[model samples]
Target chain A: MSVNVIEAGGLGKRYGGTWALRDCSLAIPAGHVAALVGPNGAGKSTLLNLAAGLAEPSAGGVTVLGGRPAGSRAAADGIAFVAQDTPLYKNLPVADMLHLTRNLNRRFDQAYAQGRLAELGIPLKRKAGKLSGGQQAQLALTLALARRPRLLLLDEPVAMLDPVARHDFMAAVLTAMADDGVSVVLSSHALAELERVADYLVLLSRGRVQVAGEVEDLLASHRMLTGPAADAGRYAERPVVHLQRGEAQAHLLVRATPHDPVPPGWEAHPVGLEELALAYLREPGAGALPGPARGRSTQTSEVTR
Target chain B: MDIDKEIRTEGRPGGGDGETAPAGRTGAGSPVEFRLDAASGVPTYLQLVHQVEHALRLGYLKPGDQLPKVRDVVAALAINPNTVLKAYKELETKGLTAGRPGQGTFIQATLSQVTLPELAGLRRSLLGWLASAEAAGLDEDGMVALFSSALRDFFNRRGGSAGGRGTAGGETEGVA
Candidate 1:
C-alpha cells in the first residue's frame, strides 16, 4: 500500500513577487478524504495546483503517488486533478468529453464511465455547456473517476453546486474511494459539508500551514473551555489556539487532552472539526503544526515553519 | 438522531435508475440503511453505531441479518468509507456484529431487550407520566428535555458512560 499519497518539504510557489504558498509541508496519507480548507486566497488552490503538477514550485520540493515527482510521467499516470469549476469543453457533447478523456489517460474505464453517466440520467449527446450546474460538476467528477487514478485532487469541487448537488457529488466521491481505493484531497469553503466526509484536515492561512492532522486527533487534542470571562486570562499560558469572548462567558479553544484537568468553574467540551477550523482561521497567527503525536493513527502531517 | 429521516433505501443515488434497485429486496437484503445527521452533536461513526443498536432494539435488525455494505452506506450517506468501517469495528468490539470475510457484516448478537408485555406496561406508565407532565404545564420541548436529563441521570447513576457510547469525547455529559 502507498504510505503517503502526497508529501512535501518546504514547498513554496511564487507568482511574480508574491508567494501564493510558502514554507508548506504536510503528508496526506494513502487512504483518506483529506479536506484542505481555508479562506479564499489562503493558498488552497495554489497548493492543489502544485500537487497536481499543473505548476512548478519556486522553492522546496513535493512528490505525488509515493516518491514520484509531482509532474513526472509515473505520477501523472496515477493521479487526476479536477481544478476549480472543472473546465470541461463547453461546446463538446457529454459523450465526446468522455471520449476525449479516455484517449488522454492511459488507464481509462470507458464502460464504467458510460454506465455511470447512463445511471445518472445524463444524456450522452447533450453538450456540457447545456447541462445544469450540478450535471456539469457530476460530469467532471465522472470524467476524473473514469481515469481510475490512485490519487485525485479536487479544488473547490462543490462550492458552486446547490445542497442536493453537493450531497450527490460527495456521495460519488465516497463511492469512488470505497470501491476503487482512491485517495482524495479536496479544498473547500464548506466546512459543515466537509465534516461529514473528511477524515483528515489540512488548514492553510495567509500562505502558511496553520493546522493539520487527522480530524479526530485535532478534535480530541483540543477543547472548547467555557467559563467566566474574567478567568480566561489565567489559562492563557496553556496552548490556546483561539479565544472568543462573550459578555459573561469566554470560550477558549485550547490544546488539551481528556486527561488534562479542567480548571475550576470551567466546562470543557469536545471541539468539533468546523469549530476548531474556524477558530484557527480567525486567529491566523495561531499555528498547530503536526508534531506527529505518538498515538496519532498515521503521521499524515508534519512540522510547519 | 432522527435516524430515519430522508433515508434512501437505494445504496447509490442512481441506484433506482434501472441499473440497480435497492428498495425491491426483502429479508435477505440489507436490513438497515444509514442516515447522517450532521446537525446532531454525534460523530458520524457513532451515529451509525447508534443506528445499528437502535435497529437491534426495535427488532428491525437481528441475528444473521446483513448490515449494508460499506460501499452502499458510503454511497447513500455520502460519507467516508473509513467512518463506516470504524462503526462496524465498534460494533464488532461490542460483540454486536461480525464481518464474514467475503460476505458483508452480519448481526452476531442482539441487544438485551424488553418483551412485548413489558414494553406495553412501560408505555402505559410513560403515557401516565406524560399526562401528569402535561397537567404540570410542560411543553413538548420541555418534556423532551426533562426526559433526556432523567435518562442521562439514570445512566450516570450506574457509573457507566451515558448512552454506552464512550468511544469519543465528542458528546457532552448532561447534568443529573
Candidate 2:
C-alpha cells in the first residue's frame, strides 16, 4: 500500500512574533527522493524539523509515515535525520561513532555501516573532528543508513562539502535508497544538484509551499508564456504563478492544463525545474492573488526586464 | 537482429566513444552504453530517452543491446533509481526497449535505417546546401532557423493536403 512519508496540514511554526513556517500543506510520497528547496530562512529547515520531531508545530500538525513525529519511541525509531551541519561527536573516532549508533539504534546494521565506511576509504581510527568535511558527511550518511530507518530527512548535508564530496555523498544516498527502499526528504538550495538526484520536488518560499509534486508532473503542467505586455485578466481562468514584464514583452509561468491552448500571439515554452522554482521564489507578496487587470501597473518591479 | 549484426559489422569497438558509453557491463554481443547530461534544460529521463534514440539512429545500440542497470545508472550519475526506471519505461512505451525480469533492459526494435548510397547522396546535397546558405550570409542560427522553418512548412503542407478536406475553409493552421 502507498503511504506518504511525510504529510503536513496547515503546518506552521513560529518563534516569538516571527513565523518561520506558515500555512504549509504537503504530502511527500514514499520511496521517492523528495527535494525540499527554498532560499535562506524560507522555512525549509523548520518544515524538516517538524517532520523529524525536532520541533513542534505552533499550529496544525505533521505526520511522518502516518504517525506523529517524535510522539512515540516507535515513531522516532522510523526516522533518521542528518542535520545541515551533520553534527557528530567530534572527538570520537569514526569507528566509535559507528559503535555508538549500533548501540543506540535498535535496528542498526553493523556490517552495512562498517562496509560503507571501508568502501569510502575512511579510516576507522581517525577522529570525527579530524576528518575532512566530505569524510564527515559520508560518515553521517553511513550512520543514518546503518539505522535502516524507513524515512531519512537530510537538511543540506552536502551544502558545505566540495563538489566531489557532494557527488560521493549523493551517490551513497542513492545506493542506500536502491538497496533499502528508504524514503528521503533532502532539503537544499542547490537546484542543479537536486535536479539530478530528486524525482519529487517541494518548493517552499517565505514559509509557504509555492509548489509541490512529482518533478515530471510539475514540469509537464507548468509553461513559460512570452508575449506582448497586457492585463492578466485575459488569462484569469489559468493559475498564473508569476509574471515578469520586459520592455515590450511579458513572460508568465502558469500552471496550465494539458489541452489548454496558449493564447494567440504568446509563445509557450516548457520550463525546467530550476526555472519553475526560481519563478515562484522570485514572485512578490508570498501567496498573493494573481495580478489585477491594470496592464503595466500590475507588473512586478522586482524582475528587471 | 539484422540491425544487431550490422552494428557488429561496423567495426565499432566494444564501447563507443567514452562520453556516450555507460560505465556498465555490455551485453553478451551488443555493446550499448548510456550517459546523462544534468546541466541540459531537458528533463533527465527525456535526456536518457533521446540518448538511446540517438544511439540507435547511429547504429551504436541495436535490438539485442542491453541498457545499463538501474543501480549502475543511479550510482554513476548520482540520480534517483526511479528516474532511470522512468526513462526505461518510456523507452518501453515507445517500443524501443524492454526489460527482462532479472536481466537489464534490452533494445526491442531497431531504428529505421537508410541505404548507404542514398545517405551518401543526401549528405553530399546537404553539404552543398550548407555551403550555399553560408555564401548567402546565413549564420549557423539563421541556417538552422531557415531549414527548420522549411521543414515545418513542408510537413504542414502535406498534413493540410491530407486532412484539409474535412476542416473549416479559410482557417489557418498553427505552427507547432
Top lDDT prediction, candidate number: 1
- What tens digits encode model 2's per-residue C-alpha lDDT throughout A180-264? 7898999988887777788788878788876677887777666788888875456645567888877778888886634567688
In candidate 1, list every pair of residues with a backbone clash. Answer: none
Docking class of 1: acceptable
Q: What is candidate 2's local distance difference test score?
A: 0.75
Misplaced by over 4 Å in model 2 are A230-238, A284-305, B1-30, B113-176
What would the per-residue lDDT of candidate 1 be over residues B1-176, giving only the tens digit for each residue? 22122334444453322322232222236866666656667898998898788777656776778998888888777789999999999998877887989888888676635555676788899999999999999998999999999988898898867446423221132112
Instruction: State the C-alpha RMSD over the true interface residues for candidate 1, after superposing those residues.
Output: 3.7
Q: What TM-score, over all chains together, does every model reach?
A: 0.86, 0.79
**Chain A only: TM-score of every candidate?**
0.94, 0.88
Backbone clashes in model 2, listed as residue pairs: B22-B33
On residues A171-228, what C-alpha lDDT tens digit does candidate 1 reach at each position? Answer: 8899899998999999998887777789989889989888777888778777789999
Model 2: what is its DockQ?
A: 0.33
lDDT of 2 by residue, B1-176 (tens): 01122223323365443333233332233465555444457777887888787676656665666887777677766778898888999988877777889877887675635444666788799999999999999999999999989977886978746422222221231111
